[model samples]
Target chain A: MFLTVLSILGACLLIAQTTVLARMPPWLGNPDLLFLLVLFVAVKVDTFRGIILVMIYGLMMDIFSGFVPGLYPAVYLGLFLTIRYASRHVIVDEPVHLPPLAAASYLFCSGAIFLYMTIFNPGTDILWSWRDLLLQMFILAILALPSFHVLGRIAARIASNRRRIFSTAKGGNRFIS
Target chain B: MRKRSKRTRPIRQFLVISTCIVLFGVLALSFMGRKELTLPHRLIFDILGTAQSGVTGIINYVLDIRNDYIDLIGVKKENARLREEIKRHQALTVDYREALATNVRLRKLLDFKEQIPQPTITARIIGRDPSEWFKTFSIDRSSSDGVGKGMPVVTVEGVVGQILDGGNHRAKVLQAIDPNSAIEVLIQDTRTQGIIKGTGDSYRLHYVLRNNEINPGDLLITSGLGGVFPKGLPVGRVSSVVSKRRGMFLDIEVEPMVDFSKLENVIVIMKSNQLTE
Candidate 1:
């Protein structure tokens, strides 16, 4: 049930990203809501559930963004696993770490994509603009904490609803018990 | 803790190994340039495309109302200016019609065969690529509308792009400004042939010899060498030309005729036989 809710949320984000956010001027910098969602899942959701959600988000991105089929999934999954491993050792779940963590992860994904394109698809030229990269990082940093907070609340709400449903199914009292 | 870790180690190992294998396989497929859409992808695209179309429509409608209200602010002065412009255009239209009639008569006198007009379908832009690196967009037309991969999409101004793929009721367009896009074109005045490659924001004319006499503002039209795009369509205009002392070719930049960012409607030229190479 949580997975379903999160998937719908991801789909809505993807839709907005491709439509409304895409229409924004490049200088304004569009926030990557899906990437932030991946980060949220990595920190809050369990490993198996988080991996599934990440893959779904990655596949949605792949379908919309690039001609390459598996690039986003690979990048996203790699990031999810790395963050999962890192969080096990470090206290990265706190809101204080979001800005830098989001920025670093964005850089890592961008670098991996650049490397992949350079090595595999050499015929195409990819202009590396530091200004654009910095702007995206800045936007991601600004949006990271708030986006995570909202996603966390949504997850909590869904989990609570599931618990209530399960309780009601077990013949628990509706209001008092 | 050691015992628990020992029990789960094999499972973790298996998961990691399987992930690596799947990643490798997927990367291999991407490297191979797999363009075909599977059944599931098509279904998802249809659903998402419909949603995008609905959202775009609502946004456009709201924008139209806002623009209408804004336009009302200076209606009197704008009306006067447009009235004068209309009068000037009316006179020009007469001269243009006379020229067109004479050209038609000359063609008939010279036994010129009339070219069959290609069937075209108009598509509305539903969504755009979210990535900065790629210049692609989704349109409302699809394979159901006779829009196939490689079909040239154009606007009233000039060439927009080519169809990348067609879902059930929607299709993706690869804009001419994408780095991967290449079109065969020739300068209108000098007839110098070159390949136009996209440079993200603009185009770069390639393979024109250093000796070629090309200038900024020279028009470029498709040479029809590639079966994808039809001949004589306006592609872009030369923006700059530079001659390097070492290279065999001149570095020429082109400004695309179509402003991709402002595009909302496009026409897809349907060529039944030339859908794919």
Candidate 2:
């Protein structure tokens, strides 16, 4: 059930990213809503399910984006696993951690993309602009707290519903085993 | 407990090994270009493209209505301005009549029409590239509309880009201002040759010798050397030229004639036998 909701959210964000956000003014920058969602899942959801959904998000990114078919999935899975592991030990779940985490993830993802293209598709003259990357990071940082807040609410609701179902099945009011 | 740990160890090892193998396989497959889309990808593209078209159409309609309202606010002033402009153009039409006659005679003498009646299909832009690195966009026309990859796209102002790929109902265009794009061009006044390459928002002309005299306002038109575009199509004007003391070539910048930021419509050349190599 949680996977279904995340999948639907991913699909909606993909559609809007391709259709609406793509049309926004070039200078304002396009925030990676899908990337934020993946981070949200990694921090709030179980690792196994979060990784699976992040992989799906990557596949959708590959489709909507003009990149190679499997490019995004590989990059996204790596990022997802990294974030999943880091959140276990670090205090990365709070809203205040959103800016730095978002910036780091954005740089990692963008750098990985450039590296992959450079290694695989040699002689492809890619214009690497740090200005554009910085602009995107700034926008993502601004959006991170609000975006995570909404995703956290959804994750909490899903978790509570699962707890309720489990308790009802065991014929007990308290969920503690 | 020791015996159970022993049993789970092999399963864990197998899962780890299998996961690594799968990821490497996916990466390898992606590393090699997959030109053909899987059936599922095609189906998804079809559905999403249709939805995008519908949503874009409605959005454009609302925007047009709002623009109309804005235009109404200045309609009277614009009407007066246009009336004066028409009078000025009417006076200029007499000179234009003579020039048109001269142009017809010159064209006939040069057999211009014999090799230049190219057919073009108009297309509307539906979406733009989601990423900033690759300057590309999707247009409403596709293979079903007689559009195909490698077709040159242009607008009334000048060259736009080339068709990169096509689904049944839509096609993706790689814009002229992308890093991957390159076009052979000639300076209109001096006939100097150089390659115009995309540098994100603008174009940069390359390969001209450092000693070459190129003014900032000189026009750059397609040389048609590679047969992708026809001869004499406007590409851009040289916006700036810098002669570096260390390099053998000049660092020249071109301001594209067509404003990509404002592009909403384009024309795709269907066929021109004279231009096709």
DockQ of each: 0.32, 0.30
- Residue A89's lDDT within candidate 2 is 90
Single out the weakest 10-residue window by summed lDDT for candidate 1 chain A: A168-177
Residues A48-118 of candidate 2 have per-residue lDDT tens digits of 88788988888877656653567788888888888877877998888789888998998988888788778
True-structure RMSD, every candidate: 41.9, 41.5
As for candidate 1, its clashing pairs are none
**Could you say which candidate leads in DockQ?**
1
Give TM-scores for every candidate, taking all chains together and pairing residue i with residue i.
0.71, 0.68
Residue-by-residue lDDT tens digits, candidate 1, A1-177: 999999999999989998899888878987788888888888889999999999999899877886777888888898999999999899998889999999998888888788878887787666566787888888899999889888888988998998988777657466877
All candidates' lDDT scores? Answer: 0.85, 0.83
lDDT of 2 at B119: 71
How far in Å is the alpha carbon of B96 misplaced in model 2?
A: 32
Best by TM-score, which number?
A: 1
